[model samples]
Target: MTISANLALAYPEIILAVGALALLVLGAFMPKQTSLVATGGVAVLLAAAVASATQPFGVAFGGGLIADAAATFAKVAIYVASAVAIPLGQPWFERRGVKTFEFPVLILLSALGMGMMASSGDLISLYVGVELSSLALYVLAAMHRDNAKASEAGLKYFVLGALSSGLLLYGASLVYGFAGSTLYADIAKAAGAEANTGLLFGLIFVICGLAFKVSAAPFHMWTPDVYEGAPTPVVAFFAAAPKLAAMMLFARVLADGFTDAVAQWQQVLVALALISVAVGAFGGLVQKNLKRLWAYSSIANIGYAVLGLASGTSEGVQAMLVFMILYMVDVTGFFACLAALSRQGKAMETIDDMAGLVKERRGLALAMTVFSLSALGLPPFSGFWAKYVVFKAAIDAGLWGPAVIGLVGSVVAAFYYLRLIKVMWFDGSAGATDKPPMEAKAIGLTAAVFAFPVVLVAITWLNPLAARAAQALGLA
Candidate 1:
């Protein structure tokens, strides 16, 4: 592809790359104020998002990148999530005396990876995007260098990530050997002509790689350890936009490129979905750390997300998109509250730490309650509707068993979420409470700003933009 064509198609990534570099350099000269760094980073990302929205290449770079509705919509959601997360991290960064510039640059770099992954039209480009994103995260996870746990988490993630990357490359090689192309649309065409061992082996390896990224069960061993060890903001990042991007890529590849091999990959995805749901729902029960709990929650949520892909339809993808946005809002809100609860540079880790939180910080505790409930799929919340859409899609596709299992998983998942609530509401007796610190207020305000509207978007069916974006992306 010509440079102009590539730039036109992936202008957002280009802008983001520049933004990351600018933040890296200017951030060094700028004052150490974290708020300034965060807001600056957010402004740059928002600008890139706006530019991407207006750009109309449609498909550029010889189909190596796509600029359709799906990619655009995912970018929009990612930007919004980053916007929400930036302020949420301000206090956390300041508390730890971390470098402001590095934080925002890492965030931008991660977003760049997500943007490229969303637009990638070929397997090679997709791997590049995933690696770019993952590398940023590995550093971010261990940014707390003084903390031994954080360093260990980063090391574990890097090692496992290397294995996953190798598996993915081997799979891609097998797929290309069988199909004669790595471009998704071309591979889809090639795979439809015949069935063979090479195709199955390639797809199986590919699924295995993606499964690890998405934290599917049997491959999710890293999650709880990583989440527990990483900084809370870093953990929050994992639970939000990055999860959405990776899962979306998983769905897109399977639904678009491997559509012809639905039967073969579907079995793998279904088994993965079931196992993840089981592990995520149950594995969180014994967690002492809130971050670890959310890690398992993420695993289960991806199970719900993957259900859409197993349906093998555009409607399924649409439902998955909606589910992802909803998941992002709720998860982000929870972490915001978690960040808010931290005092004296100490984060809230155990459920007991939240004892009498409602009494301590009324507005924030209430907001956290709402977020937790929504995540559990309770009525009148965004999460309820997110799961509702996916559940309905599964039913329509006649995957009633998985749908029912998902509902059951939701209920089990509710146990830990409610455990959080119970600690805040009923489990602990009321006591004299201290007013939350300034940092807590900032994080609370940030989360509340985005979360309430997200819930309204679910209950009222009011947002045409999301639906339109989904449609444009060939989702429904």
Candidate 2:
């Protein structure tokens, strides 16, 4: 490919990279202008999203990267999620005395990695993208240098993230050594023609690495601590966009690169899904900190998504996209609401803090209720549709046992969400204040806007977008 053509194929990533560097330099010279930097970063992301949408699909850089329909859709979703997360972080950053230009720049850089992951067609490029994103996230987690919790979260994430990356790199090396190529297409051809033991070992290791990235069970130990200790806005970002990018990569690596290895990977995916569902459902039941509860909730939700991918069919991919889109909205909204819930300028952190929340900030309270119910996969809500599509896909693929297990996990998870509602509506304040800080109204409004889809998704035109996403992946 010509230089211009490769640049065109990677236009969004180029824009993001340039924007991040500019923002970094600008922030250095004008330390007090961090907000402006953030605004500019968001505008850059929006522009990149548009560019990504308009770009033509094809292999670029000798098949190391691609700009296909699926990649475009996933890139756009990540951009939107990252954009939404920016403003939500503002209040927390200010309160923690951590407001700086680095935060937005890091997010943009991380997003660049996510975009690369979505577009990557080779193992080397995919590994590069994962590390770029993970490194940014590690810094973001520890942004509040003065906070012990933040420091701990960052250190733990860095350690575990590095370990996972090493595993992934080792797997890539094994695959390359055995198949004599790093391009997914070449690897696919090689694996399909011969059942090489080294290749099988490499595939399993790669799955393990990706599984850790998604916070799947047995590899999810870092999630609760990271989620609980990181700043709320950062946690919100952590819970949504990065996971979507990683999952998209997961689906692509399996469906596009290892299609012939379906029997080999399917059982592994099912086992991870089942274990995640069980752990997430039971783990949240005893949590006092709301963030920790949400962490466990995220784990279970990932299970539902993986179950969809376990089918290894276009319908399954479509179902996974549906589940993830709705999941993103609910998770982002829930955290936005939590970010808005402040008493005497400090953000609320526990179930008790939510006591009598309905009496004041009714809008936030109601949004929270809807989001909680949606997270539980209740009917008439988008979350219900999300789970339904995935569950149906699993059953259709003759995985009735996994489907039933998912349904049971949903039922168990509903208890904690209901408990949150009960505390907000029926319990006493127990000395916690109810008034949201003056800065929180915007966060509350953001939460409300996202909450709309939770109830209206079934009736709204958004249903078609899910179909479009399916088509993007050639699944519809």
Candidate 3:
């Protein structure tokens, strides 16, 4: 491809990268314009989404990056989710009497990196994208630097994230050593021909590293602590966009670069999925803190997505994409509900803290109930469809045993979701929470409506779009 054509193909990333730098400069010069910076950040993200949707599909940067339907699909989700996260943080920080422009800038930069991750065509680009996003997240985790728990969360995330990066890099080196190239197309060619021990060894390590990014067990030790300790809005962001980006990258690496080794990777993914589902379902049963519980919820959810990917079919990829996007909405809405509620000027962090929430904050409670039900994969909700497509894909690919285990895990996980609903509607009042910020309330309610009515209409279009995107992966 010509230089101009490659640059044209990279329009979405260029928008984000340039926009983030500009926002940073604006924030530095106009210190008090935090809200303005946030609004601008959202605008920039939306612009990138447009660019992503319209960009020509092709390999770019000499096969280091790609602009394709799958990349476009993932990038649009990441951009929109990051945009929603910005308004959420502004009110949250304002309530805490902290005003800083850096939050939006960090989010923008993080989204930029996630976009790179989705488009990455080679190991070097993958590492760059992962590190860029991870570094921003490390800073975001401790945005509330004065809070001890926030500081701890940031420190832990940084240390663990670094370790995962090391694993990824080492694996990349091994793949390069064995395959004699870093480009994914080249790696696929090499793996297809020989399927050697060294390549397989490196692939396992690479899976381990990406698994950490999605918070899949037994590498999920950091999720609960980090979610519990970080700002609620930040946790909401964490639970949504980044997970999708990592999983897309994961699917690309496996489906595009290692299709010939499916027999090997499939077993590893199944083991990871089963372990994650078991841990997420059983581990969440005893949690008191809502964030911690949701942390486990996310782990299990990622497992479901991975299950679909393990099927190694285009239908599986489509199913995974659909599930992740729907799950992202549910999780973001759940955390938005959490961020919207408070008790006597303090944030509500526990299941008990939400007792009789329906009595005082009926709208918030209703939205929470909708999200909870949807999360439990109940009928007529988005999450049910999310699980259905995944399980269906698994079964069609002769993964019935794993699918049954996943279904059982869903049943077990329903207990926590039901407990939340019961507490909100039936338990005695914990007293009225502080009036919620309008932005958070709007996001929660909007997501609830989407989870139900909007999703009914959405799935009609979403299914075909996802299938088309999956076809772009060149998967069978």
Candidate 4:
């Protein structure tokens, strides 16, 4: 199909791309009016999200892009997560005297990239989307230019991101050579014809590259450093939105392009899940930095989410979607609460900084408790439902070993999460004293509001959404 003919199918992404450019120009001219930029950014994200939900679904750009139910769902989630991050980050930016119009523009562009990634149906477009998102993220990581740690984080991310891109690109080329086309449909057909060693190698490379993007174990070396060094709000954004996008793309690529090679990729995913859970469960036990601890937690969650993907079935995809949604809501709320806590007008970095938090702020304490319990996958919480779905999917797929390993990892990870709760509620340090609360009242309230849906998701509305997503993938 002609590009113009397919344009309507890509309107949501087009809107994001165009809006990002306009916002960039506007920010350049109105550099001091950060609030205006943030408002415009949120508006653009909301509009694009609505567009994604309402737009017609089909192939576009000669089958390079797909506006399917799954893509639309993921885009909406990314948009909402990015919108939430802006306001959550604004207070910290203002306090640090680094609040700028450019920040939100970068977020818009990042969301645009993620949307593109989710919708991509061709190897070329996938690479483009990855670069677009990674470039913006690298810049955002260094937004606090004066902070040495931020600069280091940005540099490390850029270098490693570039390496991953190279690996992905090389794999794409190999696949194209063997499959005789870059389109997923063509690749699937070619891969099904016979077991091609070149194709398997290419798939491995692609999986490795994607694993790096998701911070799955053995490729997660950069996650802790980046999360620790980046600004808290940026870390919050990193923890949720980009992950949803990457995982969406990962699952799509596997299901659409490598369906015939499920046996191979499923094993890879299984290994990744096992190692990630181990690393995540044990890695945080020694970390004092709150953000770094969450980084490890993120790896573990990604491991669990991948369990569904490893099942190589539509129901598996549904389970993965449920996990992603639960993770996004809970992590977003948790980080918001984290960002709300400060010491002497500065954001707290370590778990110790939260000492006596229960005594100081009951609301924040309770919110944190709920989020922590949810993260631990305790009963009646949204997270428990998420885990249950994936584990059931794994068992249904007959991946008993992985399910048991995952459960054990969950148990091990719970210690740190529970420990944090204990410290928050029962423990105190010498530095614990009554200081004026930081400018996080709005953030704390926002976290609380977001937490309710998460707490009641299973009982109320999450199933319908997951069902819709499954229907989108034709799994229902």
Candidate 3: residue 200 lDDT (0-100)? 91
> After superposition, which runs of candidate 4 have C-alpha atoms over 4 Å from their true positions?
2-4, 429-440, 448-454, 457-460, 471-476
Top candidate (lDDT): 3
Report the poorest 10 consecutive residues by lDDT, candidate 4: 430-439
TM-score of each: 0.93, 0.96, 0.99, 0.96
**Tens-digit lDDT track for model 4 on 253-352?**
8888988888889999999999999999999888898899999999999999998889888888888988998888778877777777766666776777
Q: Model 3 clash pairs?
A: none
Which parts of model 3 have CA positions greater than 4 angstroms off?
Answer: none
Question: What TM-score, to 2 decimals, does candidate 2 have?
Answer: 0.96
Q: Please give the RMSD to the true structure for each candidate, in Å.
A: 2.4, 1.8, 0.7, 1.9
Candidate 3 residue-wise lDDT, 251-331, digit = tens: 999988897888999999999999999999999999999999999999999999999999989999999999999999999
Instruction: Write down the lDDT of every candidate, Cα atoms only.
Output: 0.79, 0.86, 0.94, 0.85
Candidate 3 all-Cα RMSD: 0.7
**lDDT of predicted model 2:** 0.86
All candidates in order of TM-score, best leading = 3, 2, 4, 1
Per-residue lDDT over 1-476 for candidate 1, one digit per residue giving the tens place of the 0 to 100 score? 66887677777888889888877777778757556777788998898889778888567777778887778878877876776667666657666776556878888999999888888788888898899999998988888888999999999999998898898889989888988888988888887888777877998998898888878887888888998888876777888888888877886677667777877887777788888899999998998788888889989988988887677667677778888888887787677667666544466678878888876677878888888888888877778888888888788988899999988998988989988888888756445444455654666555665555546754455235445544554223
Residue 440's C-alpha lDDT in candidate 4? 52
Report backbone clashes per prediction: 2, 0, 0, 0
Question: What's the ranking of the predictions by lDDT, best on top?
Answer: 3, 2, 4, 1
